[model samples]
Target chain A: MRQLSEQEFALIHARLKSLNIRYIEVYEEIFDHYCTTLENVPALDSQTTIAKLNETFACSVVKNMDKELEKSVSKQVWIAQLEFLKFWKHGVKGILIGLVGFFALAISILLIPASELILVFLVLIFCTTGGIYFMKRDAMNFSFQHKSVSVSSIAVIKRVGLLNSLMCWIWIMPIVLSGGNILSNNFFAIGMAVATILSIIYSISLIAVASRLPKSTLL
Target chain B: MSNNNLIKGSLQTIILKLLEENEKMYGYEITQRVKELTAGEIKITEGALYPALHKLEAEGLLSTEIQQVDNRVRKYYSLTKDGQKQVTSKMSELQGFVENLQRILTPDLKPGFNI
Candidate 1:
């Protein structure tokens, strides 16, 4: 078999990129297929080999790539949704534990002076901010690990990121804006509890999806 | 070459069976193997082969591993545990289909019947 030169491989890679095979995984697979098919051709020039490949592959490479991307993206979305469901299952368990803790704390608050509630509220604010910080940091770390992620995978990541940000804004912003007085309100406390649980779940799902992305190199 | 419609439904089965026998194969290798085995009578197009492989991978019936080979990366696919189990059922289904096709094509060959 005639091996391709570095220049020849570079040309093929450029051609594939030009053809808009943007996904790293798809590009690698197609590039390998082209190389294998063109390996032992009589004339081993890049243009000729590419032309022959196009002819043999019926000139529908781009269309096929688009189809593959569509299928891949849909599959990723489906898997992410399944992961989200799993996260929700665990979130519910965590919420049950939190509920038990909340009742115990409430009983303790009855015995303590009302002035100590402010200290308790301050601690809640500090923990919420720390949780959001860690969530963002973990997500950033996960994204950094895979440098060449596909558009579909990026879309999934972006979706989770958006939800995480929105949850933080919806849940955290009001408390910050009210200068911690919102904690005194029963409705605000209940809403914050629900939002915090949801934020944790979203953050976990985001990290899970990010980790599931194929490695940046070959893929 | 067979009509695409005729080959489409059985593509996954053919792929699974090939993986079962070969243990592992790359995309082009699988296509070339099919062509060689069928003596060029069956041509698996690039457009069809890849999507089928990806679909099977997404379905968890096949798993892939990448290797750097002679300056380029090659992605090899093999049957997962589920895929191994799937091969038997898929092959038998194809077998039944072929038998039914034969019966339709040659009604005289139906059991106990003579032309």
Candidate 2:
């Protein structure tokens, strides 16, 4: 197979970039596939090959496939977070860390007045979201350059930060609607307590997960 | 791929079996191999190929590595240990299914039912 010229590769890259793929890992694979397929076509000019390829591999088709890649990558990160939360087998160190997190979170929940619970949840969300941003700072840098994010970066933000924030709302929603009387509901309270402990552990695991990501994601 | 529905269920098996033979392949290479092996009778669309590859990777049956190749990065996939084991079971499963279908398609291949 002939090597695609820089101009040819750029044309394909710009087109793939236009598709606005979420993950860099997905983008690179698709870019190679498009280039390889185009190169195999008999004797068409690069521009014509590109046009033919673009027409065939429509943006929607690639986008939908990227969505699947997004889902699959997210699933592993989510599972890994839970796996890291396994206090016994995964590590005794994580057990100590999880316990520390749980104790701190439980105390905060116990001491924070009912009226301020919503504010606390909001702060918690902001912190988790902000933490991912600061922790995965390289993803931000890479995204600006290439218009795509590494799998682990997006996974940490979407699966851990965003979903965990939504999980927080479950605890605060009823409290706000029922004029704080829901605070006395033992069942709801216990459920929230369990969720709180899990979230705390999961959040700690997020640190472990984020740090585990490849530091030098390809440019 | 004319028989997309027929190919759909067997895509994973095909991928696993190919990797078992070749040891490693990138996405496009896998597609071309399938085309060559079947003489263009079977085609794996990129749309179907990628998600299937990603799903297999997610399931621990495949693993990927990224390398700079031909002026661009290419991601290569190969069987994990679990993936190697899966190939044996999946190959047997696909073969069993194919054999049964063969019996159904060509009744002379098997003893006739006398209900």
Candidate 3:
């Protein structure tokens, strides 16, 4: 067996470090074993030792696959998803601003003559757009290249969120129905109550989920 | 050894023996050598191997060096002066264990077995 050259040795050393295997004993043991094996093969010498060592290290049983480790990693991903929802909920400042806009519309609903409900309608449109924008942007960094959320995590959250949101909507249906038709006097009152209750519940749950996650530094 | 065989307590002995012959080595190589020598009889995963290596290094018996390769890096390991002495001490301890086992097993060679 050919002995490992200085360069080859350096390369091997570098590779091992990358794997986070940083012990002097491990290095020496491997070298000794490689040399000992090489010595047994009369046709090979020190020059071939590295080649043998490389092959052996590449195929070593030390790099065994571990299912437990994989499971832990996936669990972490799940937690991160939960945290993202929390993060989104924590964007309460934005939500509050949107509510301010809604409040302004409320004043208009009461003070302005019923002939100009168009102003209230326009205000509602703008508030919804602004709330959605801030929720998307401030909740998580969603740039295409630097996207942090995992697809699995997003899928899981969306599934849960959809179910939860649907429940909230169901609870708010009475308010929506009580709003009555656009031509009715109870429209604004019922619309405001339904919107307020749903927003509060959604905000509280999202923030609570984000805050309750176990603190981990793996990321 | 069989899969059911337990080599937990003997890992240090095995490590010492390997280092006694070679001047230095690294984590990946040591694991590889054990597998090759044992012909797959024993396998050490990265998870188990790293902690052991870190513990042994912490005990002041091992030192490390970082070297850069073409596209990656690796760490090489070597024994300190104290580590060398440790090898001999560990070897004798292992020898004692084997001798005791032999004495217990080969009772026919004892003074009363033939009688």
Query: Which candidate number would show the highest TM-score if scored against the true structure?
Result: 2
Model 3 clashing-pair count: 26
Positional deviation of residue B89's Cα in model 1 after best superposition, in angstroms: 0.5
Query: Per-residue alpha-carbon lDDT of model 2 for B11-84, expressed as tens digits?
Result: 99999999999978998899899999999999888788899999999898998887887667888999999999
Which interface RMSD values do the candidates have, in the order shown?
A: 2.5, 1.3, 9.5
> In candidate 2, which residue pairs clash?
none
Tell me the lDDT of candidate 2: 0.77
Off by over 4 Å in 3: A1-219, B109-115
RMSD (Å) per prediction: 6.8, 4.3, 14.8
Residue-pair clashes per prediction, in order, are: 1, 0, 26
Off by over 4 Å in 2: A38-48, A103-129, A137-146, A161-168, A178-194, A215-218, B111-115
- Of 2 and 3, the candidate ahead on DockQ is 2
CAPRI-style docking class of model 3 based on DockQ: incorrect
- Which docking class does model 2 fall in? medium
DockQ of all models, two decimals each: 0.35, 0.67, 0.05
Candidate 3 C-alpha lDDT tens digits along A1-219: 344456655555555544432223344344444444544555435456556556545534323212222233334445554555453464888578657856765676677654355344434434543443334332244454332232222333443456446644543464467662443445545554455444443444433443443221111
Task: Estimate, for each residue in A1-219, the C-alpha lDDT of model 1 and write its tens digit.
Answer: 887777777777666655655456777777888887768565436577787676654437656765676576668666875766553466778668657766765664556444354455445544544544443342233442333335455445556557656765775687699997776776665555555555544554555565565544442
> Model 1: clashing residue pairs?
A25-A219
Candidate 2, TM-score vs. the true structure?
0.81
C-alpha lDDT of all candidate models, in order: 0.69, 0.77, 0.51
